[model samples]
Target: MPKHSRHSAKKRRDPRRKTMDQITAENDSMTLKRSLTATQLLLMGVGTTVGAGVYVMTGTAAAEYAGPAVLLSFLIAAASCLFTAFCYGELASTFPVAGSSYSYAYIAMGERTAWNISWLMLLEYGISCTAVAAGLSGYLNSLLGIFHIHLPQWLTHTSLQPVPGSEGTALTAGWRLDLIGFLSVILVTALLARGVEESARFNSLIVALKIGVLFLFLIIGVGYITPANWVPFIPPAQANFHFGVAGIFRAASIIFFAYGGFEAVSTASSEARNPTRDIPIGIIGSLLICTVIYVAVAAVLLGIVPYAKLDVADPLAVATQIMGKPWLALLVNGGATIGLASVLLGLMYGQSRILLTTGRDGLIPSVFSEIHPRYRTPARGTFIMGGIIALMTATLPIDIISDLVSLGTALAFAMVCFTVIWQRNYAPETKRPFRVPLGGIRIRGFWIGVTPLLGIIFCLVMILPLLFNMVHALLGGNPVPVLLLVGYFLIGVLTYRFYGFHNSLMAPSRPHEQGTSSHPE
Candidate 1:
């Protein structure tokens, strides 16, 4: 090679010039304000998990798939989430970083893996906030009608959305926009831009209100559970994806979104006042709580109404009406709004944190990592993402884009489960305040930890159908959100090429701890 070119190549390979390597132990540049208690973290988890899935998914899953056995579907989904939650508990304690799975992946996998996870996480947050906002819009409008306040149909509906069951345009006649969903994202973005502490406090209160509303549903609706509804619990499967055992698995996969909040907890590890002790508590505790709520609500919802009649957007509200209680319906609608707001808050908060971590590692622009001088949050990135999401809500009918968030999140969970076992084998000496139980029992040749392995399997099981269906849609000429996802990933690649790759702050760092005890020095 020529002398100048050789020098340039040497500079590129210089250990000191490496960016992601520097992001290993702890970050030095971007600092997030730490002010959340364990309760706040738990609240954030519960708020995120208990949102649209319970309010919207329960009816649909029960109606279309699991029948009354939707309760079993909830159990199956929650169990799958618990295994990954154990892995998250350990990583949150081990790294105590803002990036969550991306941080753990950095330690266990490599810089490139971490960057990819971070990119996917950005999608997770953006799409989650978008979908939740859209769902919340419907409930919000319903609640508004209680006070005789109703927006025009065109302002409230999306444009040219094909109706799911039959030949239709998702609504009657004229071109329209889902303005309410768009405004919902704008409102959440504004709240998150302020700071984490404020957001957590608000999330906690919302969590409490929604939990109370759920309990009220159980308290009232349980008495009216007609014995007939629970009889054919696992209704026979009529078709491939409809009611049966296959339907239960399908329901579990669909309802997996109910557990998105627990993963969101790890993103707040940096902000947790006592991360090592509290993150585990938040992750596991919230899973347990949400599971109980889902099980009870599913049973009651199916009991109050036939499983066949439970496919509406607002299941809990529908249950109340069947029981001849419009007042209860109003309260349930109120809870749904609070539930969605908290979900959006958690998703957006996690999204910005992922961006901050990515930027800090020079995997993206450092401007995203720039914390507000006064608010102590990633204000610029939060608003940018918010604007991006708000624009999508207004212009793009995101019916398909929403599941992209769920897919990305499930992929991240699987990655975290992989990280735990990898760390157990690779860095056993590393300090972990919470470790996954029944671990390190190697099976056969290539397997080690059983807990995380189950998590990985289940995660893949959940993700595969979504992948297949998406590809199926693309092949059928509906190349919508898939194309958008491709574009988004292309943008990330360009960002990496233009800025992240060469500017990375990586330095040589030990992947495994060098302990005097282990070394016997």
Candidate 2:
């Protein structure tokens, strides 16, 4: 070979540049049991995707942003997620692995990008799990109220509550902690540590019950439609992202949290019986099903009660109360309580798997990679993440956590879309059981497909409002969210530089350590 060609080859062989074959070898070496079927995977996606959004976020979006037009917000958010879901389907099929976007980035971009994506997954899965747990606490409290059992406010509420006249611009600490939310995480973590198959079965049952509750609401609540409440479906502009056309977009961005879990199916690829085909089915099918259910339920919810009255913790329960049906309210709250627990299960499960994959790659501590000998699950990592989530759930308010989760989720999704385009351009010969539709023109030797391009654009749409709101909040004297995000980014960078950059399994010095046992050092 020519001298220049030899130099180029040597440079391209950097450890960070993990090839598709390397990723496939890693997948082949995974020990997580392959017991989940297409049906279970679909239910997992649905179980995670359908919660908090319908049970909690819908009310906030309606009352605060788009009013009755929050249904449009659901459609808009679903549209964006649908595109990204396609990108996820393609990537998951091509590279069925545990890390989901992180593993995909490792193959398509490099280790630095994979590390960043992994950090974002922490925000997406970990914090989102916390947010869901917080929402579940509200439902549980409401359900207990139906039985005339009232928990103490300090025990049921978040420690940080928004200031009354601060319009969510300020938070004040109080002697409060969501005990139910904290305990809920612990229980689900134990369930996940038990095994994936058992968790999937539990998730399936919860998904069915929630779906039935939503259908019940639709069937009965549709009859209570007050046409006047939806008079101005698109309420006039009161402020930026407050009750106008912009509000629809803003609400879409906020409620985008609702669609956060579909990609979680991709994280289950390592444990899938037939990942190539099943992962795609799970990702896309669940999104389509949940979108229809979301739109239908939103319409019924708004018709039964004016959007103005929906800014409460338990919106469906509030709606049932307005209709003078205590029985229905009890059932709705019951469904939400059980339903959000499944979301916790799915999110925590995905978070642990991401930690396992990242740890195996040496981006984080190896303890996270430790799989239980008997259960074949990442028990150690699950317990650790669950503890963090439980603490967050006990302290932070859901509104604050949800926005950060949505921002992280949107960015991760955009990276997933870009990975598809990158892989197609660089590794055209790679076999893909599923391909994102809408073939596109090659740009300077890079295949920029239409579907992935649209996915990227929609993802931006879903996050722009969030960015704007964060900026607005900063200007209005609330720098908490922005500071939190920046702090997280800096922490990620510092950790990568100090540890991951040197210890990565792909590092030249650690080449032989790529598939070591998942026991702690």
Tens digits of per-residue lDDT for model 2 on 31-76? 7899999999999999999988888889989999999999889988
Model 1 local distance difference test score: 0.78
Cα shift from native, residue 317, model 1 (Å): 1.3
Taking every candidate in turn, the Cα RMSD to the unseen true structure, in Å, is 6.5, 3.7
How far in Å is the alpha carbon of 441 misplaced in model 2? 1.6
Global CA lDDT computed for model 2: 0.86
Query: Which stretches of model 1 miss by more than 4 angstroms?
Result: 1-29, 163-175, 443-447, 471-499, 507-521
> Which stretches of model 2 miss by more than 4 angstroms?
1-15, 166-175, 514-521
Residue 210 in model 1: lDDT: 91
TM-score of 2: 0.94
lDDT of 1 at 336: 93
